[model samples]
Target: MSVTKGLVKVIKLEELKPQIGKEVQVLDQTIAIFRLTNDEVRAVSNRCPHKNGPLAEGIVSGEFVFCPLHDWKISLTTGEVQKPDNGCITTYETAVIDGYVYIGEPIQHEKHDPSR
Candidate 1:
């Protein structure tokens, strides 16, 4: 994956199908990428916050995806669980440039030093 100005290239724009979700791995994190009907792109955690369901396989309706496991509605834009559902998944910024889709920088956590 190529990183430029804090954005990591994930896939080519042509590789993503409109209204479909694609799962991608970045820095050991599973992220779900979506190409909306309007040709816009969105990125969020692949696992649902409720039951670890695979959001990539969910049905996309507008800006929301209904989790395949339990039918929990998740907002593709904000990663927020809909009413009656609790918690949220991580949302990543997405950009398409020169026919390539890019996501924001992955979260970085401080490493633990065993010798410390």
Candidate 2:
């Protein structure tokens, strides 16, 4: 599927397990989708800047995820480095319509979780 310039077709909302983390592939990019809370859903690039860690397999703690490859913590909401000085990966804008997720080509903030 051709990626919409400003949009990314990452995955279906049904493919995600609530309160669980899932990785969706978009071309060469891998996106990590997580249910942060009962009312929150977050998506971010799965690559950890500190060491190119696989973040999708990491553990979720509140608003952050601990990198499983190296134990680095990254915020799922802002895609910011929670406790390190390294840079952050590209985040995508996300939205849901009728249960399917539309990922923005760039990081876009979400005010509510559509999973509920």
Candidate 3:
């Protein structure tokens, strides 16, 4: 498939497992890519909004993933923290074509301190 101008090819669709999250690094940012059971693709920042948890290691349920550190439920589609939580992580636009996955430029957010 021909890649779009701003999207970077990340992985092949066959390389991703259903309901499993894979971490892809682009430039200096880490992103988590997910292929749901129905073959829909979603991408979000690998860092959790709370505690900077590694979202790639989180549990995937439907379109939401629970943060590994504190069980904060984050929507993979929208990157919004579920109710009772009050922050959001950046969500990247994704495209899948001819079995390849492409990620658009990520939305910029405050950088999280690694030492936290």
Candidate 4:
């Protein structure tokens, strides 16, 4: 069992098979889960980082998800920008128990680099 802030319970785990995807809504945010060839499940904010486009409806490939809005490639694992103007997407810790996928609450990352 895991505990996190905001009580963001585990939603799902690596269920989306390669070449397929799934969407899960948590609170006011929707998350898109993609299963890569390496059998890794990556979840990202369902909304596009650019125009708030629904990323859950986007096409996912490999370690990247192509935004349906402007075709922005967002990385799943590192939450880094795979393309220009594309930025990090919020990710929640995922775990699997008895073949059930659980999306843990968002990890409260401490504020760093105060020099903004």
Candidate 5:
């Protein structure tokens, strides 16, 4: 439960398989970590904003994940739900250090504006 610069240790690099989601608890917040096929790591809220679906159990496609409950496409980078959907999920910062993964505080994204 060590936190360095607001980042807490989560999991090992090797333990997270490519194109697979790994669920981890950091600061009592459940997050889903994904290792892309290109070796990039991303962290997002484990539960989807829609239907409270388990995002970790969803399918990964590119930088988006389809909610297992209703296929709501969510962006791992921006935490925004795709078009036709109206919602947002929390995104977290992730870092890999010495083969271990660390997670930072939830990223504060800009609120959606309907005036657009």
Candidate 6:
């Protein structure tokens, strides 16, 4: 992995398959990186809000991931847990630089949706 001043290279862009999640370590956090069918790369906390499920092992559908533990559908983009279940996870900023996947800090937003 390559390291820049503010970005941490976690994996290669080619190493991430579309619609699949890859587990990676950045600093002290476990992150789940996904390449969407549209080739959008997203990074989020690897644990599901509902039961602390390992999201990296979850299934990816569109922009959402179905938590492997209890089938909680979460939005990889906004980190919003879809309805029927309500919660949110930490979403990190990601970039593809020089064919490498780099992750930045957590997105500046409220992680938990109490209104849900």
lDDT of 3 by residue, 1-116 (tens): 23478888889999999988999986677999999999999999899978999998899999999998999999887788887776788888888877899998766656444458
The C-alpha local distance difference test score for the whole of candidate 1 amounts to 0.87
**Collision pairs in model 6:** none
Clashes of 5: 0
TM for every model, in the order presented, reads 0.88, 0.75, 0.86, 0.71, 0.93, 0.91
Off by over 4 Å in 5: 112-115
By TM-score, how accurate is candidate 6? Answer: 0.91
Q: Which pairs of residues have clashing backbones in candidate 1?
A: none
List runs of model 6 lying over 4 Å from the truth.
Answer: 110-116
| lDDT, candidate 6, 36-113, per-residue tens | 988889999999989999998899999999999999999998899998888889999998888998999999775554
- Models sorted by lDDT, best on top: 6, 5, 1, 3, 2, 4
List model 2 lDDT by residue over 1-116, tens digit each. 43565666666677777667888887677888886666456788988888888888888888888888888877777777754354565676777656777776665545333347
Mark the 10 consecutive residues where model 1 has the least summed lDDT: 106-115
Off by over 4 Å in 4: 1-15, 107-116
The positional error of residue 102 in candidate 6, measured at the CA in angstroms, is: 0.2
Q: Residue 77, candidate 5: how far off, in angstroms?
A: 0.3
- For 28-62, candidate 4 gives per-residue lDDT tens digits of 66777666787666667777778877777777777
Counting only residues 3 or more apart in sequence or on different chains, how many pairs clash (N, Cα, C under 3 Å) in candidate 3? Answer: 0
RMSD in Å for all candidates: 7.8, 7.2, 6.1, 4.6, 1.3, 1.9
lDDT value, residue 38 of candidate 1: 94
| Clash counts for the predictions, in order | 0, 4, 0, 3, 0, 0
